[model samples]
Target chain A: MKTSDFIERLAEALDAESSELEGETILDTLEGWDSLGHLATIAMVDELFGKTVSAMSLRRCRTVAELMDLACGEVTP
Target chain B: MGRVLEAQGASVTAVAGYVPQGRLCNEELSSRYPEWSAEDILRKTGIRTRAIAAPDECASDLAFEAAKKLINREDIDPEDVDLLIFCTQSPDYFLPTTSCILQERLGLSTQSMAFDLPLGCSGWVYGLSVARALLEAGEATTALLLTGDTYTRYVLPEDRNVAAIFGEAGAATLITKRSDLPGHGAIGPFVFGTDGTGAEALIVRGGASRHPQKRRRLEMDGPRIFEFCLRRIPGLVHALLEKAELDLDDVDLWVFHQANRFMLDRLRKKTGIREERFAWRLEEEGNTVSSTIPLTLESAVVSGQLKPGMRVGVVGFGVGYSWGAGLIEWTHGGMQ
Candidate 1:
C-alpha cells in the first residue's frame, strides 16, 4: 500500500478525517486513539493485509509514518 | 482382545439456559464510557444487555437453577441421573468441588458420579464431548451437563474491554444413550485444539496457586484475542466438517460460541457460510462464557430454527485459548 493510502486508512480506523492526519502526526495525540482505536487499527491491518499486528507493537510506534512502516514491513514479506 | 463391541450412541436431548434477573444494557454502558455510544457497543458486540449475577449468587447457584428448569421441563428424575459434569471458571468454593455440592443440593443419587471441569468459553462443547464419551462407554445412562460462570464478578467495572462483553449465565443439557446404532446424527468426530502460550491473553491473574495474593481483576488483550479467533476458527470449522464427512451445505445450523458480533461475522465470512446458517443470539445475554453455545442452541430450538434430525455443527472457543467442535445429528434418541 502507498504511504498516502495507509494514512487515509489509519484516519478512517481512528474515526478521524484523513485531512487531519499526516505522516509525522504522533499517534498518541490523535483523537479517538484510545484502546478501542487500537483494536480498530489491528482489525483494519489484518483485514486489509491478512497480517497479524500485535497491539504492543502498535503501542510502540511514535508516529503515523512509523505505524505505516510497521504495516508495510509485514506486507512486504 | 479378539473382538471389539460397539459402544452405545449418545446425543443431547434437551438444553436449558438461565441468566440472572439483573441486566446491564448498552445504554447504561454508554453513559459510563462517553466515547462509545450504545449503538457502537451494539454494533461491535451484538449485545444490548448483559445479565449480572446477584450479589449473593454463585456459579453453582446459577447452575442449579438451570438444572432445575431442565429437569422440570424434561420431567427428569434427579435420582436417575448417573453422571453430573459441571463446567465453570468460577466456583463457589475452592474445596469440595462445585459439582459435588450440586449433587447434594440437587438431590442426585449417591451412586452417581459428579465432578467439576474448570474451563471457560470452550467449556460447553468440551463438556458435551465428555458427556457423550461417558454415555457411549456405558459408564452413564443419563448425564447432566451444567456450564455456568459469573465472569461479571471477576471483571472490574472500569475494564471496558471485558466488562461490557461478558455476562453471567448458566446452562443445563441432558445427554442420554440410545440402543440404536449410530448413523448421520450421532455425536462424535470431535476436533479440539489448545494453545497454552496464549493463556495470559485472557485471564484473571489472581486467586490461583501461583498468585494467590494478587487479587487482581480480569485482564484481556482484545487485539490478540481477535487475531487468535480470526486465525483459528475458520480452519477449525472446516476440519470438523471434513472429520464428520459432511460439507458446509450438509450442516443445517452452525452455533459458534457467542464471543462478539464482529468476530462471529468475520468468521462467517471467512468460512464462506451464509449469515442465515450461523447462530448469532448474543443481542441480550452478552457473552456468558461457557453458557453461550447452549444458550444459543436453546434459543434456536425455541424459535423453531433448529429441529430434530437436522445436522448442527457446534463450536466453542475462548478462554483456555482452547477450542472444540463437533457435529451432532439433532436427535432426542441417540440414533436410528
Candidate 2:
C-alpha cells in the first residue's frame, strides 16, 4: 500500500478526516484514538495489508508517521 | 482404548434456552462509559440489551431453568434421560461437577450418567457433538445437552471491551437416537480445531492452579483475538462444507456463535454467505458464550425463519481459542 493510501485508511479507521491527518500528526491528540479505534486500525491493517499489527507496538507509536512506518515496514518485504 | 458400538443415527429433537431476569441495556452501559454512547455500543457490538444473571444466581441455576423449559416443552421424564452433559466455564463449584448437581435438581435417575465439559463459547456445539456421538454409538438412547455460562460474573464493570459484549444465558438440547437413515434432524460430520497459542488472548489470568490470585478477572486482547477468528473461521466453515459434501447453498440457515455483531458480520462477508441466510439475533441477547448458537436456533425457530427439515449449519468458536462446526437437520416439533 502507498504511504498516502495507508494514511487515508488509518484516518478512516480512527473516524478522523483523512485531510486532517499528516505524517507528523500526534496520535495521542486525536479525538477518536481509543480502544475501539485501536481495534479498527488492527482490522484495517490485517484486511488491507494481510499483516497483524501488535497492539503493544501500535501503542508505542507517538505519531501517525510512526504507525505508518510500522505498518508499511511489515508489508514492504 | 475403546471399542465402538453398532452405530446408530442421532438427532436433536428439541432445544430450549433461558436468560436471567436482569437486563443490561446499552443506555445503562453508555451511562457508565461516557466515551461510548448507546448508538456507538449498538453500532460496534450489535447488542442493544443483554441479559445479566443475578448476584444470587449461579451457572447451574441458569442451566436448571433452561433444562426445566426443555423438559416441560418436550414432556420428557428426567429418568428417561440416559446421559446428562453440562457444558460451562463458570461452574458453581470446582468439585462434584455441575452435571451431578443438575441430575439431582432435575430429578433424573441415579443410574443415568452425568458429567461436565468445561468449555466456553464453543461449548454448545461441542456438547451437541458429544451427545450425538454417544447416541450414535448406542451407548445411550437419550441425552440432555446443557450449556450455560455467567461470563458477566467474571467481567469487571470497568473493563469496556468484554463488558460491552459478554452476556449470560443457558440452553438445553435433547438428542435422541434415530434409525440410520438419511433424514432431517440427523446430526453428524463435525469439524473441530483448537489453537492453544491463542489461549491467553482471551482468558482470566489470575485464577485456577496456575495463577491462584484473589484478584482474578477476565482480560482480553481484542485485536489478536479478532485477527485469530478472522484468520481461522472462514476456512473452518469451507472445510466443514467440503467434509460434508455440501455447498453454501445446500445449508438453509447458518447459526454461528454470537461473539459480537461486528465479528459475525465480517465472518459472514468473508465466507460469502448472504446476509439473509445468516442467523444473527444478538441485538437483545449479546454474546452468551456457549448458549449463543442454541439460543439463536431457538429464536430462529420462534420467528419462523427456521422450519422443519431445513439443514442448519452451526459453528461455535472462542475462549479456548477453540472452534467447532457441523450440520444438523432441524426437526423440533414446534417448527413443524
Model 1 — TM-score against the truth? 0.92
Model 2: which residue pairs collide? none
lDDT of each: 0.86, 0.87
lDDT of 2 by residue, B15-91 (tens): 89998999999999989989788998898788999899999999899989999999987889989998999999898
- Predictions' DockQ, in order: 0.47, 0.44
Docking model 1 quality class: acceptable
Q: How high is each candidate's TM-score?
A: 0.92, 0.92
Q: Candidate 1's residue-wise lDDT over A1-77, tens digit each?
A: 88778888888878788998898998889766876677778778877787767777888999998988888785754
Most accurate candidate by lDDT = 2
Q: Alpha-carbon error at B70 in model 1, in Å?
A: 0.9
* TM-score of candidate 2 versus the correct structure, residues matched by position: 0.92
